[model samples]
Target: MTTEPREPRATDVLTGLLADLRAESAVLDDLVAGLAPEGWAADTPAAGWTIAHQIAHLAWTDDWAARSVRAPEAFTTETARSFGELLAAGLDPVDEGAARGAAEEPAALLARWRAGRDGLLTALAAAPGDARLPWFGPPMKAPSMATARLMETWAHGQDVADALGAVREPTARLRHIAHLGVRTAGFAFSLHGQPAPETPVRVELTSPDGELWTWGPADAADRVTGPALDFCLLVTQRRHPDELALTAAGATATAWLPIAQAFAGNPGKGRAAGA
Candidate 1:
């Protein structure tokens, strides 16, 4: 009997992530369209960030990554080693808004966001697979770089969706985010100073269009199974799995839930930017 092949190209993953970004951006745009001017300035679920701030942060991050990609050699080895640390330890950008008393205008923030995102898409589309970029650790290829952006955009967008009391429907493109979450399982546990649990957990996602997506050892004794939206929210730390009907069949699987991280480093001691 013949077996199926796997798709592991980082470039392909980045391409998919870009598509998800566009999709989630559309949903966010729609959500913002009906908001009153005050709503745009309203603080998000995050500690001190408003919708405008969140959008601005995304734009800033995109420009940062693109700059790094365009000039990897400019970064020192120490900079690379300290990448994860800086990201984890840095103060929240939006929190500084408290001192300023208000956020930038929403319309201006949105325009800034769109420009950054479009610029990133253009850069990634033209980048080669081996294009190196400065990251929290060492350097990353264009594909990994794209994945990082994808994870951020989706995770942050969840905060916006939650703040609006609206749910952004999950799509097949979420597989990329799901992949990042699965890959980061070990780091997530370690961020809490615990050893990675030995038990393997299965993950199954039913896509919006009714297709099934899965990961982990096929016969692993533990599992997380649910709609892709819930899985994404749980892994992204936007919602607690137990509260969201996410099924975990073993102790290790349950433990992994609280610390399941998708981003590169320790997300630190609490909820993410917009969750």
Candidate 2:
């Protein structure tokens, strides 16, 4: 009988992802810490979410994940798109309840948020090495789960920073972001109905630890290099790389800019670095 290919378990990758999540969360908090009340209501790059909404969303997701890990039975299978959805939507209903006059105070929200985050970490730490849990649209094992959380936090946090006109202190753990970017190279081409580029593109990202994480050919003329955070921001459509110090070479690398998509499902016509 045929069997599925085994997924890779690089503990290092998961460790890095966890670090990234924590770092980005700190950045988000710093951006909001001393903001005037008006700043909380400010419109962010996210279409309809305000700065406050973004923070609430992060808190909500961590709580959702915690609940799902603790008691997967509370969420009906019919209501969830995937196991991932159950966790992602975890504390959202509570937040929405508060938004709709449920009267949750800011202090209450903060306390709930910390509890949720801690719960998620606890669950992750205890999860089996090979456990394949449901998430958003597909089943991801532990490492990917960590990476996805980190990516979402960083991407969304970028919106908050942008809205506040503040700069985030990025970390090397952003290599996780850059890694996802390079891995999606083929997806980027296929999304636009174009054949995958024949030439291999090289990616080199400087991690927070001062180590370099690389993918593809080392000497390839077509290359993308920058601080990992900027690469992640560009590909995720959080910010334009042109606004940062990110560099790209070769026509193929440049052409793939508008089509990069790290997430699964339908392809997106995301804005290019210049667009």
Identify the candidate with maximal lDDT: 1
Clashes of each: 1, 6
The TM-score measured for candidate 2 stands at 0.73
Model 1: per-residue Cα lDDT at residue 205:
76
Candidate 1 clashes between residue pairs 3 or more apart in a chain or in different chains:
83-136
Off by over 4 Å in 2: 1-16, 34-36, 67-105, 189-199, 206-211, 219-221, 241-244, 250-252, 264-275
Candidate lDDT values, in order:
0.70, 0.67
Candidate 2 lDDT, 87-145, residue by residue in tens: 58675443363253213344555556556666787687666667666644356677776
Candidate 2 pairs with clashing backbones: 64-90, 84-134, 84-135, 84-136, 172-207, 172-208
**For residue 90, what is the lDDT in candidate 2?**
74
TM-score winner among the candidates?
1
Model 1 misplaced regions, further than 4 Å: 1-14, 33-36, 75-102, 137-139, 268-275
